[model samples]
Target: MADSVIEESDYIPGKDELDWGYEEGAEWGLLFPEANGDNQSPINLNSREARYDPGLLDVGLTPNYVVCRDCEVVNDGHTVRIMLKSKSVVTGGPLPSDHEYELHEVRFHWGKENQRGSEHTVNFKAFPMELHLIHWNSTLFNSVEDAMGKKNGILIIALFVQVGKEHLGLKAVTEVLQDLQYKVTHIQHMIQQYTVIFIFVLQIEEFRRLRSHVKGAELLEGNDGMLGDNFRPTQPLSDRVVRAAFQ
Candidate 1:
């Protein structure tokens, strides 16, 4: 919302200090159907802080384009891909090579539902469509659903987009969706669906100073509470999908 990611303050905030809208949203964009994810912030096993490193994320580098797929935010004529990871290209890293997780596709989000759709979850709240840097835990977990069983199977960073102004930087994603025909249009895009992503973090100081300006602060009160009521924390969606798709 503030165009900033969370900075680690040695001191955690009071309940008041904590509100909805994690800064990581700006680091990535939205979650679409075509990709796997790496949501490491909320359940940080390696770091004691349990948050994403703002310094290690770059919003522009994640999914920069989206094809018009008519899934959630995508239409049918456009394509989007993030060209941010220079290190991966240089070393040709598969990324998180340790776990065998990979990048998939990118999408969009908003403050209002259907008005928006998102990837990550925080306190049971989902945003319009927060981008998910989705990844799989290759070692112990066979699939993304299986990994959600462990505390470390998946890593999702939840970022909230404010409602006052248009996200100009996000326009590239929206414009392409516009060019495509709605309701069964065929869009083409080259979003890298592979393993590994190189993230560039934002400065925490910039976020702490700017949090005051983000609009639509009712996230926890509105969407989050509703989600907590629907499912068990970290429960597998396999049962749900299987039941729905087949039944």
Candidate 2:
């Protein structure tokens, strides 16, 4: 039995060795103890229940992004990830003023059908897809590796994708998904203007107007093999509080 033990050196973070699937995520806690934690993510966002925090409204969510030329789109088995090479940061809003979270990577979560792709639901309703912009606390740590598992280490801005006309901002990235329709495949590509995409999605007015339609899965029709429904199921909120900027 001693030969069956897995060594730490052989472990790769974010690389699932157990071949876990979305339907089997409930069992993830068995292998990943953190998955069982009370603060686990992808909780349903209840619009009516979320407390309106004036602090978030007063400070506002601010992003400082620049045009990035050195970026790559990677299909890392589970999802398609856009690895950002340039330094971009977000401050204010729900985050503590003392720390600035630096943007690291962006990931997409989609579904097999148009009705249920998003991980977090609004009033028990699911969107067609979701986009996650992941950031790490750069003020306290040198890199994401050093910030892992720490309090206030990571910040994720999740955007729900609705069916609508083609989104020009997403064209560059979605077009590249065809080439990365295989596991672990990657391509060096510029993610358009990072500032334009982020600002466009973050603004409530702009987002609402642009939500009437998007190419949705039509653009990714034939690449279902690698891009299969990759969303995680919502975890229990437990004792955590979800605050919103709007009342």
Candidate 3:
């Protein structure tokens, strides 16, 4: 089956124009009706109106990430993706009790310009870029592919990027951009080990201070002309309500 699967290619006849061709758009409803589904992602987060759920404030998170060596990086013509081999497990945040998710891959999205590129926006404003850390339920599912078909199967954490100081953690990743100018190229990276147990409990003011301090590469400045706008339009919130852990 793997041999027959047609992966996105770098030099596909007219792949560039398909960037904003929203696969989840209503226009494609006949083919992929889920594109018009109610629970679609990358919603605009109206931070002010987000409900301050006390339960969300206590969202338990256990990030067991270790220093990874020789991870694969691929430019699949759509996005620059880093396929992780680290046994990074993230459990608790936005999930029910005792369910654990394993980090499968990390990918990026950005704009041709710097105004907006992230899939999810805050208060309807766009960020320069965004990082999606994709994970799949580890307890019930055997593999990430198998887990993607069920509800609560996959959990994605989106981190928005602002143009400011250069992120040290991402700096190493960016250095390889020059080598990846051509598409369909794959390389192995000996990444720096920045290990931290990410506890997403936004409990108190002091903890909020800790939250601000607890940073490594969540925020990043834009690099010129890295990749064009690779983001989906913000979907309707529908019946879903936004929840926040902190003010």
Candidate 1: 10-residue stretch with minimal lDDT: 238-247
Candidate 3's C-alpha lDDT?
Answer: 0.58
Q: Write down the TM-score of every candidate.
A: 0.31, 0.79, 0.75
Candidate lDDT values, in order: 0.29, 0.63, 0.58
TM-score (C-alpha, index-matched) for candidate 3: 0.75
Instruction: Kindly give the stretch of ten consecutive residues in candidate 3 with the minimal lDDT sum.
Output: 204-213
**What CA RMSD would you report for each candidate?**
16.8, 9.8, 11.9
CA lDDT of 153 in candidate 3? Answer: 70
Report the lDDT tens digits of candidate 3 across residue range 198-219. Answer: 2122111111111111113243
Candidate 3 residue runs with Cα over 4 Å from true position: 1-31, 193-226
lDDT for position 54 in model 1: 47
Candidate 1 residue spans exceeding 4 A from truth: 1-97, 109-129, 137-155, 164-168, 189-247
Best candidate, TM-score-wise? 2
Predicted structure 2: lDDT:
0.63
